[model samples]
Target: MCQPPAVALSLTVSVLAESESASAALVVPHSPVGHHTDLDALRAWAQHCDVVTFDHEHVPQEVLAALAADGVELHPSPDALVYAQDKLAMRERLTALGLPCPRWTRARTAEEVEAFAAEVGWPLVVKAPRGGYDGKGVQVCREPAEVEPWLSGVGEGGLADGLLLEEAVDFTRELSIMVGRSPSGQAAAWPVVETVQEGGINTEVLAPAPGLDPDLATSLTEGALRIAGELGVTGVMAVEVFEVTRVGPDGGTRAAYLVNELAMRPHNSGHWTIDGSVTSQFEQHLRAVLDLPLGDPSARDAWTASANVLGGDYAELYGTYKHLMARDPGLKIHLYGKGVRPGRKLGHVTVYGGRSGDLHSLEALRERARHAADYLQGVVTE
Candidate 1:
């Protein structure tokens, strides 16, 4: 997330133009999260570049098609990118592909919603078909009345695209599989990791998903690759999956998995790979998009934990970051280079262990990472 495009475009463009490294590059300030980039500006920028790759799914579909028409190569072509841009399309495609997802339907009207709820049961979820992120556009409804606020705005014609409704999953934990693929069809997957979320924002990531069942992990990796291939993905993709407990015929708990969402870009969940893996997601993404040889996706350590640093009450990041470096040299910090505002994602810290000279345990790594993040955000003094 760069600053909102309309707000920062002129300054961002001028800065990039003057930068030595950006001599051949034309830059556009990205639209804020969950909004589409300006099509005309994006087209102009793409005209100067040989190939176009994306870091977010906020570009409009028509913009992608136009770029392709302009003879600029696009990784994750518009046809494949549609699923990531629209949840309804994603659900339909995944279901058609026999991939597991929650029971869901189109919430076109209140009547249709009631009918779907009658089958899926109460406490279902409602989601905007487009432009929702970081907990926005998603809602949990325990009853019918809770849905009106969303549907009321469409007027008499109703929403042609409509909203999305799904059975709220009861998951033990959220897991993400990051995979990189090329147009040549080669694919590599990083170990599945457990993501910790608060208020719909991802706060921490535990790599290798502590004690994850080996067989299940394998299934997730292969399945993620299968999806990437099916979607003709040509860059790193993050498949958000869930590990849920299902009751057996005899009423015993059995672990099962379901696909939650798909992100066709380097995601927050894969940030730990920057420090803990043989290849970082950002590097791998470039390799994939360029159709170059893929890099190894193996972990450098047995455990790695990544914590997000949100802007807190304290505005000065300098002193807190200094304290973190002095206190934990193993911690790696990455600042997004954005102006900080309360609760905004400013940066992230990664810490790894399970080596001879390192923190020895997974919990220790987690604590170390979290403390670094908290300290940087000025949430914790020590």
Candidate 2:
């Protein structure tokens, strides 16, 4: 996460470049929580860095705007980043771009939600316009009975000034495509990974998603690239797509993928690259924002799988490293140094290794990864 404000980068590169240590400098900037970094401190630090980028798009737009005005280079400039920051803006832009997005309408109250739902159908998906991450600000509404209580509770403008109502989708599988581009227009794409989410939060990602037809991958990649290019996106961005199935006239089934959402940074899905690919997303992000040459994204091994340790007991789970290491000497675990609360993405574990083109099956790799995670959390005996 320490890719911006030159002082932090210098300290980080110095440490990582040294062969002995792997720990890097991390710059904590001002956030909505008002707990850590503040804007003045960040602006002062930005004077030293050659370029700046992000791991998440939560930085206030005004701060980015002020930085740009003062001659700081922000990759995927704030103008472009806005689409990723605000869902309302993103939906409008997607429609203007003629992309295939789920049909949606905006509502400010229960009455509006009911009207929008009637116009569409029952069992709609409602989302807050801003500040919603993972599954926190989303709800599934089967009818007005479920909508009124939520409206009265949040009072529409208080928590969710604007709510989005969309038709629920029935899909075959969810997939993510990570694409990166340099300022010079050099672009690279990574292998697609199938994602599984539980209770609105991503829980697992299987690399080189099995059974994905070559044609489908090609189309998805091309579409993702096109969108990035049109949006003037620089650095790494992940596009999540849902594969929807429909019945054909001749008693057959047809498949089509729809754009689910876009994230313009190093996403959790790309975390597998730390062990599986020649270059990880974190490094590529550094290159892109620095305007340096992009690196190869090809997987060095055949298979890779990632499992998230989510919504767990942190205090009871923090000190089990020895047990985890005992069971899986080969497993690679990365724990984000954030206090764990329920479903907070405390960290991830990735497992991968095999012949160049003959990786282990997803089921086998995922099982091993899960076991390693359970061991680390003391849920299973080592």
C-alpha TM-scores of all predictions: 0.88, 0.85
Tell me how far candidate 1 lies from the true structure as C-alpha RMSD in angstroms.
5.6
Clashing pairs in 2: 6-49, 30-37, 311-343
Task: Highest TM-score: give the candidate number.
Answer: 1
Q: In candidate 2, what residue range of length 10 has the lowest lDDT sum?
A: 14-23
After superposing candidate 1 on the true structure, give the runs of residues whose Cα lies further than 4 Å from its correct spot.
1-36, 155-160, 250-252, 355-360
List, residue by residue over 253-339, the lDDT tens digit for candidate 2. Answer: 766678877899989888888788787887777777777788899987677889887646546465678767777788888876555
lDDT score, residue 380, model 2? 72
| Candidate 1, position 158, lDDT | 23
Task: Give the clashing pairs for model 1.
Answer: none
